[model samples]
Target: MNAAQLRAAARARAQRWLRDRGYLVERLTPDELRYMTSWSDAPIPAGQPVPQRDDPRLVALRRRYDELDWPVTAHSRWSDRSFVDFARFRGDSLYIWHYRESPRVSALKYFMFLRYVEERDHKGWLDALGEDGAFGCWTFEFPGRRPVSRDLLDSVNELTFLDRHLQLSGWDGLRALDIGAGYGRLAHRAAQALPGLRDWCCADAVAESTYLCEHYLQYRGVVPPARVVELPDVPSLAPGAFDLAVNAHVFSECPREAVRWWAEQLARLGVNWLFVVPNEADGFFTHEADGSRRDYREVLEQGGYRLVVDEPAFADPAVRELLRVHDRHCLFERDRP
Candidate 1:
């Protein structure tokens, strides 16, 4: 399908998703909507050309994401419950920032315990950063039950494996690259969580994400540590210069060719370790709009990468065991002879 057809399908899907979720369905007070629409780097609205997609479905989904349009409006799905949760997390985060703890920090381990599905863990923020003065952040769903946002949680969780299992530490000291990094979340986390982290690259296939991350990292004061590497620049980087590379969120939504591109790119880039959270039920796979499946395992193997770490989303046994739904995360290492 062409761009117009793709846009229409995306519009129908997003409108249905928002409407069904009662998003944009009501007005809210300023306090109730404090962080909702307050994001400075929110994406452009839908019906706009998105960063140029090579795949029609990807274009449609990117359009859909814009339609979801976060820094959610009061009229959007900013629920009273979500407001309470966000406020509570923010309050605790601020307290943690001050190196003071809140009782809410403890309550975080139990919040939304059932929805521990997807990359988002089921709770609030609890852990303080090892980095001085960086304070508390909401991170880590694996080895579950931390008081942090899903994004942060996912970052810490992914990093923990590298830290504890792979014997990698201080991301600043290593050559690091993040593929498909959106808005520089991991970059922010690495800067915050690993104060010693020296060099990091935030690369994305999406033009909007690449642009947003470039600005977002600077806005978050993590610019030098987390530089945005645009798609066109990927080929220019020195090969075998990266020790680790990360991919999160929507990678599983990629088509076969996209997966191959990533694999081949990482292989050529000489990245040793590949970390991903594919969101597949059992194994690494991406399903097409037509129900065809592309198992990324095949692509990775063909690229001379192999799975080394595989487990439930959470590192904590209890968190993984207590999960109402199961999601697995896998780590792959590039081992070309």
Candidate 2:
């Protein structure tokens, strides 16, 4: 089935599952629907997107998130549930940042996020700098209750640009290095996408994430011991190790100085293509509070890399919703600069 069909099928299944569990499903209006669309669907909302304190629903959701550790299955994906879960994992320390202080638009946001996850079929985040103060201290959790890798692999194909580049530029035959490959979602999908890709490495600074990847690989029974790396050897690693390097959610959450260092290392890796991901508006917080969001244009420019093409946001419905909630990933490539 096509992306739209797959999305509809997944939504139907999810809605049915939610209904069976006694959750009400509300049909979204056009405006509400738009909000759940990809970040590129609409222009970035004007200043201070945070809901007002007087807003009862927003206030209630925020209060619940702040006070209670709610069940992940109970709340909507977009609802305060995500924020609460995130806050639980990350701690309330980020609340000190005024922009992140806003109550999450839980219900709407969760719908978008889950859809994106389903569509994209993977949750990609950058590897932290092995520092406690980075990336909100959110632990990587893979809901690997079942074999969902195929579902995610199909979802990533919605990006015409990425698919095209892989086919046209011979990325199909290369080895892949997924930096900060949270839960091996992207790495798994990449493997599924390109049959000729013989070797794949899912590297992250966290041992927990690597463990999850190993588990996933074991479950799939592809590689006896899949390349799940947990080390700080990006800088001095063997040269030309992988043909493609994907840094999802890595540049933004890592320390600013570290981002530059990683960039240089990636450059030296001599990879044919590099994918640097960051969220749309709330990358390092809701409003650039931590300055984690790297300027892709600047980073590439300074690294002396040429931009082949850029995908503003994903077009897959499910992928788009994911963008709304967690990230708005864009792809950049440089070949033989």
Candidate 3:
């Protein structure tokens, strides 16, 4: 066979191999092929291996988590039985920090970081908090900046966004509550960022989350300002104690009932302001583990919170599109009294 015929035969075989593996094969132009090849060759950093299930600490936390009477939706995605990877909480299990270490993803995150720095100009402030890559987190070094991980970038961005909306920087003796406070990521950052922050309560329905939050905040040496409030203990919090409440990428993962329960609790606590970062960009929806969605905005509204601010996670449209980040920063205020 001639050279062109041999090339066609090789392409056919490649397409067939892909088809057998359930991938739809398509003809790729030179540029597309190069992009695909680069992505395939991207280096994925090694993460901490999952710890043994029977680790005494994990066993204790799991027992505590199982003891709670969680709302059906609350346990959907965060239960002990289904979510057994909590041991890698700091690495990639709970809050994602490792997967973005690949070349393409890291570059996009760096650009997003640049956009955040340009808009907020809080790079120095964030750098001060430091990124030591504790507990097997993935860290990346950007030019002219201190080492950083998704934890640092995301926490600083969210905190700066909250400061912009709520004036957290100027609020003296500001008390805040974190709903679904996984490993106290925001709590530690907020405690460091807001010296005037009187009390930062980290609350989570997942027992393992509560366990990790307590340990993580203490490890970061923010225990005096940051404390973990178990789901059951949340009801004991005094009303009007917290000036603001923050939920990052949490409501979208909860069930409708769980969302309602949290809204009710926040209302009962008389938290004046609520800042939520939903996984959805255009609408308020709950993402159930069973692959279902339900509108949760009405639940919060019925609980007396009114939507006041709804903006893209990244203020710049170009940055948003380039990073493919559709998350939104939503701020709500209590409607009554």
C-alpha lDDT score of every prediction, in listed order: 0.56, 0.46, 0.76
Which is the better candidate, 1 or 2, if ranked by TM-score? Answer: 1
lDDT of model 1, residue 159: 64
Candidate 1 clashes: the total is 20
Candidate 3 lDDT tens digits, 109-197: 77666557546845356667877777656566768867777788788878778877777888899998999898888899888888788
Q: What are the clashing pairs of model 3?
A: none
Q: Model 2: how large is the Cα RMSD against the reference?
A: 17.7
> Which one wins by lDDT: 1 or 3?
3
Candidate 1 root-mean-square deviation in Å: 15.4
- Measured on C-alpha atoms, candidate 1 has an lDDT of 0.56
Best model per TM-score: 3
Instruction: Give candidate 3's error at residue 146 in angstroms.
Output: 0.6
Model 1 lDDT, residue 298, Cα: 87
Lowest lDDT 10-residue stretch of candidate 1: 72-81
Per-residue lDDT of candidate 1, residues 1-337 (tens digit): 9999999898888878899888744445663354333321123435433322244544454464445422211111112122222112222321122112232332344343323333332222125432211112332233553333544445566666566656555344776888777667678777766666777898765544555566557756777877977565676889877888887754565556666777887888878888787766577876454557667788889988999888876645676554432556678887767
Q: For model 3, how many clashes?
A: 0
Tens-place lDDT per residue, model 2, 231-318, is 4445557778877777765555444444455567677887767765554533232112343234545755566566655454555555
**How should the candidates be ordered by lDDT, best one leading?**
3, 1, 2
Model 1 segments more than 4 A misplaced:
1-147, 170-172, 289-291, 315-325
Model 3: lowest-lDDT 10 consecutive positions: 36-45
